[model samples]
Structure formats: C-alpha cells, structure tokens
Target: MNSPAFRIRYGFEAPECEPQLESLLAHRSVRRYSDQPVLPSLETTLKAAAQSASTSSNLQMWSAIQIERGEKRDRIADLCAKQRQVQTAPLFFAFLADHYRLASLAPDRAERLEFTEFYTMAVVDAALAAERMVCAAELAGLGICYIGELRSHPEKVREELNLPRGTFGLFGLCLGYPDPSRPADIKPRLPMNSVFFSDVYDADRGIGDYDERLSQFYREQNMGDATWTQRIQDRLGGPDMGPRASQLEDLRRTGFAKK
Candidate 1:
C-alpha cells in the first residue's frame, strides 16, 4: 500500500520511504462504514491528538461536540444535507471555531473576538486541530470523512448544537470502521510543482496533467464524467455550493468571520 500510494500521489516513487509517509499518503476519505462500533478510548486519543496541534498564539480557540448515536445524530445528519455517513458513522464530531469561552473569561474585552482576523484565526485553529485528529484516527486504522455541510445552515446548526454567540460550527467529522466491501480510492492531487514553491509564489504552475489523470481515475471509479477543472468551476462559479452562498450573513450574525 505504501509503495502504490506514494507512486499514485506523487506520480513517482520517493528515493527513500518511511512508514509515516506511507500512512499519510494512503489517506482516503471513507464514507461507507461497517457495523463495528468505535472504541470509546479512540475518542480520547483523537481529542488528545487534536489538542497537540499548534494553535495561533496558543489561543486554543476551537472546540468540538461529539454526537452520540441516536436521534440527535440523525437530526444532525439531516442538517448536513442528508449525508448518510454522518448518520451511520459510529462517531460524529462537529468541530467549532470558538471564542465564546475565552470571551467569557474577560467580559470587558469580549469585543476583541468580533474582529475578522480573530475569526480567521479561530477557523484556522479548528482546521489544524481537526486534521491532527484525522491523522491519529488514520494511524489507528479508523476510517474518517470530513463533512463541510455543517456550514450550509449555520443558524440551524447553532440552534441544534446550542452553540454560543462567539462560536461557529466550522465542519463535521465522521469516524468508523471501513466497510471493506466499499473501498475508497486515493484521489489525485495537483503536482508538487503546482502547489509548492520556493521563495516567491509561482502563480502559473497550473494543474499540469491532473485533469486527464483525474478524469481516468473518476471513470475507473464510475463517478461520472466530471473533470477536476469542471468540478472546481461548477462548485465555485455557482451560488449553490451546497446552500452555503448566503452563509456569510449567518456567520456575521453569529459573530464569526465578520468584516
């Protein structure tokens, strides 16, 4: 898996490969899961891993809500645009960009949390923490998927989670044991030259041959006739990016990502 994953991800093999690199390259968003229950300890380990991630100014401006399996989880899944993975996963987490706790500690300066830069910092902090947890889960052989639909109906999600004014649901995470019958493929990414740069940024290092590569990959997976560029344009050009076009107002109302 290491050798193939590395080859597929980079379009070439590394001169030397380590087990950690293999684990990282092997990542695929797993949506289908088996009926096996997730160990309770796994949540603790993941949270610990998340806390270990670097935060902006050590502000720790992120929090998460784990939805236990039941009616609440089903409601959350429906809120996330009927994403079945959220409903079926053994563990579901709504990761939040939170300034509410910190603000409570100093009521007089709570207004500082309303700034756009602070909101951006919180969003980045939450994303970093969530990624660390995802890495830990993958290392432990647990399958995971990130659900961005949580932001689609920001006010509704806030009401459902009982979120405070200075906290916003940034995304959701689904965790479970992978159903081997429904395997996930490694999606192709842009070439290293296209994304990584030295010193000054290189804006012209386009997608290279990724379109063709991903087109074939999609066809092999029977995922319909959508190229990478087509998908990107369709998602970004339209107002319907999963009902999230008007979410900025919701964020402003919730005192997050405002400017």
Candidate 2:
C-alpha cells in the first residue's frame, strides 16, 4: 500500500521534505475520541519516552500523574474548564512543575529553590517532557490534546490531586484513539521565513501573509474566517485571564515564584 501523500496543510507543498519528517507536519489536535482504551503497557512506554526528554542540567524538575477514571477524573475535568475530552479520553496526564522532590532531598538548600529561575526551569522541563510524550503517542497512531485550562484553577487542581507544596499543575494531556467521524484538520502555522531568522533579529516583517493563510484555512474548515492577528488580539488583549490571572499568586502559595 502506498503511504499517504504529505503536504503543508496550510495550502502549500513541500515535496522535497523527507517522507518521515512529513508525519510530524501532519499533526492535528484530536478533540473527539473513540471508546477504545489505551493499554497500560503502552502508557508505561509513553511515560518512559517523556522521561527521556532533555532537562536543564539534568534537574528533572517535572512529574505527571495519570488520573484514573472515576469521580476524581470527573472533578479534574471540571477543574480543567469542564472539557469533555478530559472526562472521556482514555488517558489523562496532569503534568506538573515539581520542586518538591529536590527540596525534600536537601532541606538545608531549600532556599535556593525559591528563585524565579528555578520555577521557570520546572515549567520548561514539564513542557518538554509532555511534547516528547505527545510525539511518541502520535507515532503510535494515538491522538492527543493539551488542556491548558488546567492552569485556570490551580489551587483547586492541587486539592483534587492532593498535590504537595513545590508542585504546580502546568497542564493536562488527553490521549485516546481518535474518532474518525469527527476529524480535525492540521492548523496552519507561521511561514518558515517569518519565524526562523539568521544571526540578528529582523522585526520588519509581520505575520500578514500567515494571517491571510490561516484565515482561508479557517474558512475551509467551515469555521468563520479570522486573521491570526485577530485571534492573538482576542486571546491576549486584556489582563482578564479569568481564574488564571491568579497564577502568580497560586505559584507563590505552592512554594514556587518566591522572592
């Protein structure tokens, strides 16, 4: 059987690109999932893949909890802005920025963990691990969606998971066998030249071309057309980040982001 032809779904062709690399370009967020359950051994391998991600100086300041199906998952779904996928996906991983383990190892050096840089490292580490896991899952023909809404109610999430101090829920990942009946398209991204630059930064070029491309892509998906600039404006225009506006304070309360 012939492999599926790959193209830049944003309305361009990159036939010169190697076929193996093209699979990475074909990623799409799968919101709807079938009732199939991901096997326990597969999940173990996925976590191992995540753990293989690089960490800053090998600090490994990250952790994840696979929420089991039950009342806890239901509560967690509500905590994550009530995303139905969180409730129904075959697997859910609450990735955390964890400093607790390190602090516990050397309580005398705990003061060093209070710096903002440490907190940033933890968040970055968690993100790297999660993305690596996502890549592995996609390779295995599974679907995934990131739930950034897990940051909306940080304290509540801590309570739901019984998280200790020095651990913050960075985000959630929903994993499952995708429901083909409700397919999602590969969302367009900024063109390479616009994002990748040489030595010095060139701020002259704007995202006008990408905005137009994405606008057309949205229309093709039957969603109302809107420029990428407009979407960014809508998302970042105000300090009204709802419950997430208190993230700094929440992080502080969790023993991170301290002065």
Candidate 3:
C-alpha cells in the first residue's frame, strides 16, 4: 500500500513497484528548461532507440526532423501556437507519419498509401517510435514536451519542412534538461479499475472518484477548478477545433486517408 508510483499518479495505495514501473509512472511534461544542451551523441543514441521500436510489417513508415535554433526553428515554433518551450528547448524534433519513403521505393505499387489504414499505420508507427525516444531521453535525465499543435497548420509545416506528398507532420517534441526552479509535478490519472476493464466493457465504472482526485490536483497546481470531465467537455463539446478543423482536408491533400 501507498506505493510511490501509485501515490504520485493515482493518489491512492498499491503494491510495490519495480524501477522500470516507477520510471514510467513518474513521467511529467517539463516546459521550463535549463541552458544545458543535449549532446549530439546522446541525440544519436535516442534516435537509435526510436528506430528500435517495432514497425508495421517492417515498412518503417515514420521519420523525425531535428530543428536547430534558427529562423526555421522560430517559424515552426510560431506555427505551433507560439509555445515558449518550442522556441527555447535545446532539442526540437518534428515526428512525421511518413509513407513517402515506401511509396518511392515501390512507385508502381504505391496505390495503397492513399488508404486510411495505411495512414493509421504510419501514425501509429510514428507514435511508437517517438515514445521509445522519449523513454530513452527520460532515462538520460532529459525532459520533453510534446507539441500536438504541429497539426494546426499542416500545410505550412509541410512546406516549411519540404515534406513530400505522403508525409504528414504528426507532432513536434521539445527536449532539454529540466529547470530545477520550475519543476513539473506528476499529474494524477483515473483509477486503474475505471480504465482497465475485466472481460467486457462496464459503463457503470464511472470517473466520479477520479474527478475528486483531479479536482484536488488542479487546486494544488493553481490550474483552476476544472475537473477532467469538464476539461474533456471544453475540448470536445464544441465544433470549434480552430485550424485543426481542416485536418481531414489537409490529410487528403497530403495523400492520406483518402478512402
């Protein structure tokens, strides 16, 4: 009971944890960073770790573009809703769901790239690879924040990155040494029973308990009184997805999800 991982993540008690479980449960998004740089050698190692992730049928339909500090980096940061971490992080990477490489390799048989299934596969591949890289970076004492706002202006990102027809800018990542002064705290999640169902789905297992816990967390973090349910409502209850509303059209233009 009162295991470190459970305490930090669920605000409850659980059995003891292994080191790897503790590491995974301790993840937090760090926006403020120290001036310490992530070395190029370490970057390579992290990339290798990403490459080690499993791919769909070994097609490996994903790629990452490192953006150094420059005009292009600043432009991309602006494109990602002008996030301060994006502009200032020591290492930035744009993870792409890329079908271009495979299509190019077999140009005559590239018809399948336009299907939604292929698009989904590419996105899954990119996510898996990026997660592997993130785990490796965290193990190396580096912190990261993911920028899903990269999809806000997909066309602009495509043009800026010189991406081909079958490559989509899925997301961006910011990595650096975390600033001690502005440390991030691990946020609580719903109870395991609420999510991990036994045999069949159980709608009766509501998130009322989690709402109370997350409300407390929000108050402690000075993040206002919005509970997780309220947050979800605010995000999804409206049709105003801003520029992301054009995502389907953008994806089609980029030769994905056409089916």
Candidate 4:
C-alpha cells in the first residue's frame, strides 16, 4: 500500500485496515511560532482534556503550571542547557508531580496521608496526566515537545515556579506552531514481541532486531547514528555522574526520598 503515514514511520509497507484513527499519526513537535496567540477556545478545551485523564485511586495527584511569561521561559531555557526553543515556544508547561495538593488538604498535620509518600504511584499518576496533555495538544492542532532536562536543575526550577513541598517539576512541555521547514516524526518503537509478553515473561528473544531497525530509522531521520546502545552509553556511561545522577539531594529537598 502507498500509505504515506505507515511508510513515513516504518519505511516499509503496513497493511491499511479499517479503523477511525485520529490522524494524530502525523504528529510533530513545533519549536517556532508566529506572533499570533493560541485560540482561547482551544486553550480551554486542552485544559479540560488534560484534567480528564484517569487518576490514581481517585486521589488526582498531578498539576500543571502553564507558562506565559517570557522572562520565566528565558530562565528555564538557561537552566535547560540553553535550548533556545524553550524560549521561542509560545507556551511552556511545567507538569508537576503534585502530592502536596493532597497532603495540604489533610485535616491535621499528623493525619497521616499514607498514600502520598509511596514513590511508585506518584510517578504513575503524574505520567498519565502528562500523556493526556500531549494527546490533547496534538488533537488541538498544536505541536509539543517534552523537556526531560527540566530535571537538570530541579532546585532552580522549583524556586522559579515557587513549587511547594510535595511537588516537583517532573518535566516541561513546549507548545507552538511547528516550523514547516524543520519537521519532526514519530519516534519508532520496537515490535510487539519485544515489549508485550503473554502469561510468562521471556527475555533475550530477538531483541537484536529492534536495535538494528532503530539504528536504521535514526540514520534516516537525520539524527546521526542515534542507535539505542550509543544513546544509552552517552546518557548512562560516565567516568563521573551526569546531570541526572546529581539529583539525589534535589529529590530530597523536593520532599520524596526513594528510601
């Protein structure tokens, strides 16, 4: 089949089937913007969609700080390895893994908000909302990029955003109109065999194929040999600790010790 979407993603043919997909397969992240502001209706709907995501045990633990000020964006850009796109984007959102909201609402200091301190749930809840926001933004004709480097200086980010205890900027999202000249594509994922498993878990079964396919995809994407192993080595292999390894103290200050 001459399906542009499948070919663009896989560089091979995929069987076209009957399904009402949202056409979001054309997803791309935009770093440039015109002087025009995002439509207010779209903004309202996007927020509604972000809120609509499922919550953990109905505790609803995530919060997002929508950024509009240029000075604030400039400061964040400075902290995030001076990525100029951080400042250029019309909208930036600091997606907070907000346990503080639930804790603050506790009737008493010793009321024992047993749920807040659990590390695993907090991450899951926050991630779900952030994922929802991304899908919603895409549906709204907006381009978005995830800023994982917000963790580079969590303390600075917290101070800048005035984040209270039990809340941390897990990540940032940049949103705006994508520059047509510089387009983005859906990052490829391994086939179902690698990630999805049946009753019993299995390992070391055809994993090498994924690494090779991903390497080829990365090269074609003009990303310069972005193989999974090379990327992991650069990110994780260090004679000294990298940016993320420096976060032990910051995480403590933000009020969660993995223990």
**In TM-score terms, which candidate is top?**
3
Kindly report which residue stretches of model 1 are placed more than 4 angstroms away from their true locations once superposed.
239-242
Per-residue lDDT of candidate 4, residues 151-226 (tens digit):
8888788889899877878888887766766776666656656777889888765454556777877788777877
Please provide, for model 1 over 1-259, each residue's C-alpha lDDT reduced to its tens digit, 9 standing for 90 to 100: 2377867776777666776667788899999999988777878998999999999999999999999889999999999989999999999999999999999999999888888999999999999999999999999998899999988888789889999899989999999889999999888788878898999998787988888888878898888868899999987898655667677887788776666
Q: Looking at candidate 3, what is the lDDT of residue 191?
A: 87
Task: Judge candidate 3 at residue 92 and give its lDDT.
Answer: 94
- Write one digit per residue (lDDT tens) for candidate 3, span 1-259: 2357578677766667666656677789999999998888998999999999999999899999999988999999999999999999999999999999999999998888899999999999999999999999998999999999999999899889999899999999999999999999888888888889999999999874888888888899988978889999988888788999889999998889999
Report lDDT (Cα) of residue 21, candidate 4: 44
The TM-scores of all predictions, comma-separated, are 0.95, 0.94, 0.96, 0.86
Model 1 TM-score (2 dp): 0.95
The lDDT of each candidate is 0.89, 0.87, 0.91, 0.72
Model 2 CA deviation exceeding 4 Å by range? 1-6
lDDT of 2 by residue, 1-259 (tens): 2223234453456647666665576788999998888888999999999999999999999999999878999999988878999999999999999999999999999989999999999999999999999999998889999999999888888888899999999999999999989987877778777778899888986664788888888898888898888888988886687987777889898889898
What does the lDDT come to for candidate 1? Answer: 0.89
Error of 2 at 181 (Å): 0.8
- Residue pair clashes in candidate 4: none
Clashes per prediction?
Answer: 0, 0, 0, 0
Candidate with the larger TM-score of 1 and 3? 3
